[model samples]
Target chain A: MIEPFTVLSSRTVVLPVDNIDTDQIIPARFLTTTQRDGLGRHLFADWRRDAANRPREDFVLNRPGAEGARILVAGRNFGCGSSREHAPWALLDYGFRAVISTEIADIFRSNALRNGLLPVVIDADSHAWLLAHPGAEIGIDLRDCTVRMAAGREAGFEVEPFARHCLLNGIDPLGWLLSQVPAIQAYEDRAACRA
Target chain B: MTAPRTLFRKVWDRHVVVPETAATPAVLYIDLHLVHEVTSPQAFAALRERGLKVRRPDRTLATVDHSVPTAEASWASGLGEMDHAARYQVRTLGENCGRSGVRLFGVNSARRGIVHVIGPEQGATQPGMTIVCGDSHTTTHGAFGALAFGIGTTEVGHVLATQCLLQRLPRTLLVELEGRLGPGVTAKDVILGVIGRIGVDGGTGHVIEFRGEAVSAMSMEERMTLCNMAIEAGARAGMVAPDETTFEYLAGRPMAPQGEAWERAVVEWRELNSDPGAEYDRSVTIDVGALEPQVTWGTDPGMVMPVSGRIPAPAGAGHRKALDYMGLSAGAAIAGQPVQVVFIGSCTNSRLSDLRAAAAVLRGRRVAPGVRAMIVPGSQQVRAAAEAEGLDRVFRDAGAEWHQSGCSLCIAMNGDRAAAGQYVVSTSNRNFEGRQGQGARTLLASPLTAAASAITGKVADPRPLLEEGRRIA
Candidate 1:
């Protein structure tokens, strides 16, 4: 089971670009390993590295005071494109606990929730505030379903109840499904009998 | 059962193993689970970690794409020119599939190809089925009246362990095309035109049901080309009602039922359409009769314009960023933009029909002096069919590389890529920045458009070239 996600308080790393797709999060070339660990090193590899594989100093993650930022404030349509879970795995491995965006792609939102990495969709005004004040302190509370900024401005967000329950209780989706083996087998057996 | 219901309601209702409650989602049984090397390794590893065996290995089908090279010798060589990591990933899938008891269309198998292509080709994708994979384009199967969509690896693991998925109900959007397509327009152009009308996130939280005269008139492969880009429109999936054409495509295939069962299946499939006056949550209508050939002049699929039109002024931040990344300015004609690379493959349009159309354009012509082009068959079956029809000879004689069946240059995970700062006219979906390669600018277009661009070395219209069809032979 992944770590239980409930309340998270931290400074944020801002990337003010729309449609930041999974390809930009982790390039296809770095997706070879079967293991999920160590992917944090390659998160945003193309944007973080130069032609010679040296770290680009101008990148948001590589700059000073960017280390250990546990939240990401990104633009709209964050995590679009491929359904690669490597995108969220890399994000969580890179020390992000939550992502604040104006919009998030469907499959990516599901993937992030399963991994206990929160995907928070806020209003445009709140998102603009986060974009303007880079490194702003913010708090996310699953109990209240709201995000609180440093300046007392806040916005309510939506999350599926079951996904929220699993994240709230450190419950894994596969584990829950495994517990329903009898029901699944019965369904199949009935279909087989019909055939 | 007599109440009016949408097509989505029909398929989704039949697959519910356990209904949703206030707290949990419906546990839907999947009829087919298509797997690939890129997304399934971790899923198998997770099963091993949990000491779990595959609940229904019979329903799962795996393949080696996204990581395997497409060189002439690569299939037989096993390791071929693949780097250490690529070779490792391919081998891992083999080991995983072997230990899990799932059937794998390995690198050397004649049935191997892009996951989407081989499924329909083998008849594993059929009417009234609920299909899924770890790739976003799994919506391609919805052409056969199936309720299909992509899932992430975590859900992949869940399905592997139980042969089921937990999902909330998605809203239905009826996208109706009023009339038949124009001469030069194709399934790709129709999809592009729709995505351009609705922004990328317009279909978010909904599954699109395509209905009308144009959809009814298209072939099964053409319907697949239209549905394949549903994800680009941020749709959960895209669907079309099954008809006689769908049954004809599935008949006599190895995986399809024979004799009495086939007749019974057709009867049931006939009832899979939306009833008269069934309501959808939302609706949109487009007139395909007057549409022009479409092309993406920016970074995303929604930033598209007709081939005969000029790029429009940016309306917001997203369009501005797209134009900046594409190195284009407003009011410039999308035509005459030079391209260095041309790719004509992917799940969107790599069928035999697509190959024949491209070959028809390049029949007695040659690729431009500086343009590098490649035509990757969607599957081994497609490659063999093209070879038997002499289409491969046409492509090679016209100076395009006739690559083997694999996802080459589309995802670029197999060491096939356009160089930095190069312009590429591609038939694949998703022209996101760095999707083809780092700093590569991709213009998404129909296979016919891509073929014409390869000949002219610039973005060009395909209608005139296609109208010049009778001159050959």
Candidate 2:
């Protein structure tokens, strides 16, 4: 079991960039550790940190008001490259509980959901509004599957029921699959019989 | 019972262990799981923490890549080139696979290579199978008509505890490539063209089946190249129907069925293509008769144009940001830009054929004085095959660095990287900022283009060079 992700209410940090790939989220050089902890420091290692290994003050994450923001508002096709769960690991560890975009890549969405990071795909209007209004208060309720923002504007998003249940209860999907061995074996046995 | 089914549906239907419901995903049994040093370490750690043994060791295969240094050719030194943490990740994978009874082609093994390359190299990938890995390019196996996709470490643990993944079926998108492909237009160009037509997110939440005469005519390796980059278009997986080319390539591989079993397998595989009248959620057709060799000018693969084209001005802030990261001016010619390095290896284009293609261009022609060109074969096997053909000598004679096989410079790990802010013409899959190195600018292209760029020390079209060879012949 992991941290239950039922609701999140926090100001959003806007990085209005499209197709923010996993490499940009966390470069491949930092992917050596077998463990997932301490990755928070390396989230967007290249974008957040400058060439001299100093934090660039211009980046949103280093700015004063950006502290404690839990929602990330990015452009379309966020998380577009590499299936490294490190992207979400770094995001979650760095205190981002949700990423809002108009289009979230397929594998990244699955990875994010399995890791308790809500990949919120909003409508173009809601996405545009979110991008235009960074630091705006937004609330997410996994039960209703809605992302509620300022001025009563909200968008309904989709999360597979099983993934939603897993996120809501802080249950890892592996345990559920582990419990269904008999079914898996039965299916394999049937294939053998047919063969 | 008589309804037509897509090839993807056929594969997905056969792999179902338990059907989906309102509260649960379908239990999809995996026939093969490819593990590499970088992604599987954490997944194995999770299994060890839970005291769970791998459910089906026979179906699981492991290799060391992404962290294995291409510079280290001696196993006796034993991956000594890797730093502490990278070495630890590889060693942990070795220990975990040893304890779990899974076969690991470790850094010490000659068969070691990129996970995607050796999976097919070993014939572990087959038609009508369900395949998964922790790397997004697992779609490479779909060239064999398998239902393959990448998963996260959590799902990797699930497959370890049970050789099955809980997945919601993805909708199907049919991409049909017709017309005659021109010279110097390899599979890499075809895929880049597809991604250019369809935006980066065009195939989001879908599995794409590449169909038509152009796909039918492609070699198995070429098809792998095409399917390998479907992820660049946000596709979960990419597929091409198994035919003569597929079976012919699989016939003598290590794990393929032998003799009578192979005959029976062939009979069954003959039916693996989609049936007539198969329904699809979406369809698109691209005419490749006039298609030219393509190159990516922007960071995203979708931001590409023909080799003779100019970089388009930014349409939005996202495009502007990509242009800034790429360090290219708007309206500038995509060609003739200075380059410091040229990389000709990745899961996308590191096969023996890719090596041969690059060697063909590099033969007798020296890489420009300032350019540092590196040619990394996709697998040890590919390296051996290229060496057998004297391809390595051609690269070396052309002033390129010939290295051992691994995902070198493609992911920018293993110290195989270009310096910051330097431009590189690479034959890898992604061109995201800091991908080849911190602050490095990447212009993604095919092996031929990379070879030409190495010779010119700048981005250059390969058509004239290729045409010269053909005309001489």
TM-score per prediction, in order, is: 0.98, 0.98
lDDT tens per residue, model 2, B1-473 = 68999999999988889999888889999999988888887888888889988989999999988987887453446665568887888889999889989999988688999999999999999999999999999999999999889988878888888999888889999999998788888999999999999988888889999999899999999999999999999999999999999999999999998899899999999899889999999999999878988999888899999989888988998788888888888999988999999999999999988988898788888999999999998999999999898998898889999888899899978868888889999999999888998989899999999999999898989888878877776
Q: Write the per-residue lDDT of candidate 1 for residues B1-473, one digit (tens) a residue.
A: 67899999999998898999989999999989999988888898888888999888899999987887886666557555787888888888889889989999998799999999999999999999999999999999999999999999988998889999999999999999879888878999999999999878888889999989999999999999999999998999999999988999999987887899889888999999999989899999999999999999988899999999999999888789888889999999999999999999999999999999899889889999999989999999999999999999999999999989888888988878888889999999989888888889999999999999999999989988888876555
Q: Per-residue lDDT of A40-148 in model 1, one digit per residue for the tens?
A: 9889998899867899998999998789899999988998889999999999999999999999999999999999999999999989899999988889999889999
DockQ of each: 0.79, 0.85
Error of 2 at B417 (Å): 0.5
Model 1's TM-score against the true structure: 0.98
TM-score of 2: 0.98
User: Quality of candidate 2's docking, in CAPRI categories?
Assistant: high
Candidate 1 chain A — worst ten consecutive residues by lDDT sum? A172-181
Please give the lDDT score at residue B373 for candidate 1.
88
- Give all candidates' CA lDDT scores: 0.91, 0.90
Top-lDDT structure, candidate number: 1
Alpha carbon deviation, residue B48, candidate 1 (Å): 0.8
